[model samples]
Target: MESIFHEKQEGSLCAQHCLNNLLQGEYFSPVELSSIAHQLDEEERMRMAEGGVQTEEYRTFLQQPSGNMDDSGFFSIQVISNALGVWGLEIILFNSREYQQLRIDPIHEKAFICNYKEHWFTVRKLGQQWFNLNSLLTGPELISDTYLALFLAQLQQEGYSIFVIRGNLPDCEADQILRIMRVEQQQRPKLIGEDEAQRMSVQPVSDTPVPGDEAPLDEDEEELRKALALSRQHMEVEDEEADLRRAIQLSMQGSSDPTSPNAVVTAGSSHESGSSEETLTAEELRRRRQAYFDRQQQAHDSSTAGEVKDSGTKPNQ
Candidate 1:
């Protein structure tokens, strides 16, 4: 539903986004998660100091940066686990032997925190539906019950560490509303900045409205090829028509340049083979343009019919 609080990606604050989205509100901020990370770092530092202050390992660890966080605003999973603990929620490693032994289905879980590379996101069950609250997405992605397990498995395959959230999530308007009535997504949301990136590409936009579901295959490429050809065809027609019109206007103005290449004089002849060519009058040019357009239309219709036949579908029209 529209009430879902989705934070579009900004900087490397995915950990902040992940926790806040999981809690279904702006429950946590960068400062809060960073504080948690620093605390974890201090604890690790004190543990290393126990190995004796002068030890090689302790000195080497001191020289290195904090493992719990980095300059890019990334927080370790330990930080996330600790942050969730603040809400009385337990975090379980999904792939751990103890949890895997239970044979529990992922769809029944209330929430999941997924991490890949350094990006973090939440796949949470709001009311009766599950939504992928990835900060990189334009908005919350509705994941069908049947596809939830498959989606998690795909993330796991792609080297993501998935943790199960075991507790009641904070109350939110989206969860309260979706529980009463379901919402269906007609079109999936694109990734954040995806449309803008596409607009910046070098390709000129086509006049034809391409179907959104067009496959990226030979068929789609062939259609684009036709569109390019049509673009060039129209450009050629317009240029020739403009030249003829200029000659027509000049002729009516009584200052026509008869020797000009585009001028439509009363007579014309070629000496090479003693052959003759008709003067290209304005009326003749209009007739020729109509004929040219008719030929183009017939060619386009034939191409469409051939494509429909090849695709093994009945022509609906």
Candidate 2:
């Protein structure tokens, strides 16, 4: 991890300045980080110290007690991958109009389980600038959606806005992912930006049908909201019975293609023709659904048996 922290030769002080700003920023919590830092090893600790990682800026940051956002100092932001090589988070100052971008050292490669918190956001890169939302999941734990959601919720409460990146995940897996993140996300309300607020304040002149503009319902589209709600329930069942081995196998295969849209592509006739899209057969979908329900039933049975043994609930004669 320290290998990646190799200081910028050109922006030595500027980088430090940036670090100081981030440590003092309104969107960050230094007290929380101190708790995190206490868990570091000797080598990691030395790396931070040698890098002047400990400074008055951070000290001042820690002085404030946990959970107080009002006392946070200036806005500081940096994109950093944690000590664990597998994870990365892109940090950006909320007020800064310019986007900061970073790319990996071309020679190194690994499958990053990219996730983010806050609101749904998109990513784009132009010249040296990069635009994306922030996140804080690292290493193996980074793979879980639940963890990603929790981190976002925590940051939101600290006054940092989140923008989640939605890459290609199976609908089933994606549903389970949200469940894990649901608790953390509950604390955060839907965030609106300045532009959105302005738009909201400016009410449209007419709710009645306009000449050229028809309501969205006129156009045929999937009932995404309804389907998603059902899908959410469907996915919970799948998570209980999800074959970890099969999921891993699919993940590995998905990584190899690089061009594939989803982490787990459904094999089909279109797949044989080299079409980019992935599809699942009805049979496959049904099988997964069945497996999920079966798992849930088994769990329910076990819980009932335990209740009976403990005499927590009376059994039927």
Candidate 3:
């Protein structure tokens, strides 16, 4: 499985990044996902308005850092699943709290989206191990089953929602799934909370945008479009050499700043020479530094050899 990180982007879009990784071949840019999310939010608002259901709680939920509606970063699982359907994929969602209902055996080759508090991440099982693709990490990290269970329990305790997705389906199947979701959505009741009712009784209904209305692109959307264009250009020319160069640069930067987020953390490793709360001794730190440089040299030589091999394979014009 492939893992992608949010990189320098704001934390609000971790879910968007996770989705991008999940549907890798589809190439749905973050901008496109954000647009779909915004449209879905608008649709939900319209539904609430029609049903005379005040949307204070829902609006609050959207405005939170994890689900910033204005930034087009956060999204509900239903909205995401619906958008995936539009992209020609079938999504099966499972509430994480109900472990018995989860089909872990069939998830071997599938993507799993996990939600924890205000953060969103992904994990996948390969063989007997699980790899975490949390956006905050530099790369996919190995996670133990014990850690996974504890993490899920913590999320549940925090009143956070969890969803597991099984995606990528045949076009015909996707169409059928989308139709079913639409029917279910229409039949779902829009419940009005007592607080919402009391608040709405004193205030007039807020004006809502008409369904299917097109709005001009905002600043955030414009920036996202530019980013997506640049990303496409990069993807067109990306190769192993480019990856090696990036890896080397990141390694150098991390070495130069021991306090950097990318710095290697050997806290719980069997080879850890220092305690988590203790600083490394001078000799131990030097040894680590030497080891890092040795790895960098090996990678540099390998990348150079690959480049030479590729050049030799090219036919003479």
Candidate 4:
């Protein structure tokens, strides 16, 4: 979970300031970026969870080599030269459109295009980061890694510094990276209201501490309880959504079949030996299905009657 509005404010501000500073020619590059690049393995020279790797469709982007390999290789050499006292390195990616491109796709309804680059490693914020892109790639897989280094090099040429840090670092590398860069940490930024924030901040605690509570919970206990309730309710409203969608699709298929103009019975009966090709009246089939569901619901309700009553009872001396 990420807080787009709250968590990104600092980075967005930093990026803006960097842009402004670059405009005024107030940029300075540390000579050590190349030295830092040398300390990193060829595998570590990439970004994490890049969309190109996750989505099969975008994978083709990494197959072609960029023309700046020699320049990137030179940049890597320079980073390795100044590797001392470096705490960490991150690759900050920005799409060509910058923040304006940040959007949630309506089809998937997921947050995307937040970074500046069209691909992964577009935003490299670094600290205590441990990821291995090498294991996932077969052969050299040079295009992605090469272009990533090249991109950082370009940013460096534009007055941005990129380097790797040495020694152990914290698990919360993102926050740690910001902190190292003299940035403030954001606390659960997605929480909109004070009440929401307070609710999330509080955890359930028991007044009485049970001793020897070291044993793990019985794996089946909670699962069994839930399963029993699900069986008893027979209401499976959640499951009905998918079934309804499938039924609609089947109905459409049946209606479109030229042989059965109005409707056609789908082959393959789900239960027992029954009429496989016998066309059924739409109304009749629906009634039968409803009756079957009703019977299951009745049986479930009866079986869980005792538990339902127990749940409503008050404790007595």
Per-prediction TM-score to the true structure, in the order listed? 0.64, 0.25, 0.39, 0.19
Model 4's lDDT to the true fold?
A: 0.30
lDDT rank, highest first? 1, 3, 4, 2
lDDT of 1 by residue, 1-317 (tens): 68999987898899999999999889888888889999998899899999898999999999999889898898988898899999999898876767766767677899998876677889999889888888877788888775565455435433567789998788999999988988887667766655655654545677775455233335633443332221112211333344343333333222133223344533233467684545665445445545756776787889999999999999986
lDDT of 3 by residue, 185-271 (tens): 112111113234345456544587545434555675444333222111101112233322233222322232333333432212123
lDDT per residue (tens digit) for residues 1-317 in model 4: 12111111121132222211211221213223323443443333244224446665445444544322223223332232233224242222222223214431112111111111111111222321111111111111111222232222223322233222223322343344534443322221121132443454464666675553333325543342232221112122223333332332243333433123234434333447543444544444444445656876887877677676879974354
In angstroms, the error of model 4 at 265 is 3.2
- Runs of candidate 2 with Cα error greater than 4 angstroms are 1-222, 234-286, 309-312, 315-317
Question: What's the true lDDT of residue 81 in model 4?
Answer: 25
Model 3, global lDDT: 0.45
- Once model 3 is optimally superposed onto the true structure by TM-score, how far is the C-alpha of residue 276 displaced, in angstroms? 39
The lDDT per prediction is 0.70, 0.29, 0.45, 0.30
> Which is better, 3 or 4, measured by lDDT?
3
Per-residue C-alpha lDDT of model 2 across residues 60-141, encoded as one tens digit per residue: 5445443311122211111222211112333333212232123222112111112121111222211122211111111001
Q: Please estimate how well model 1 matches the true structure, expressed as its whole-model Cα lDDT.
A: 0.70
Clash counts for all predictions: 0, 5, 0, 26
Ranking by TM-score: 1, 3, 2, 4
**Candidate that would win on lDDT:** 1
Q: After TM-score superposition, what is the CA distance of residue 255 in candidate 2 from its true location, in Å?
A: 11
RMSD of 4: 23.4
lDDT of 4 at 86: 43
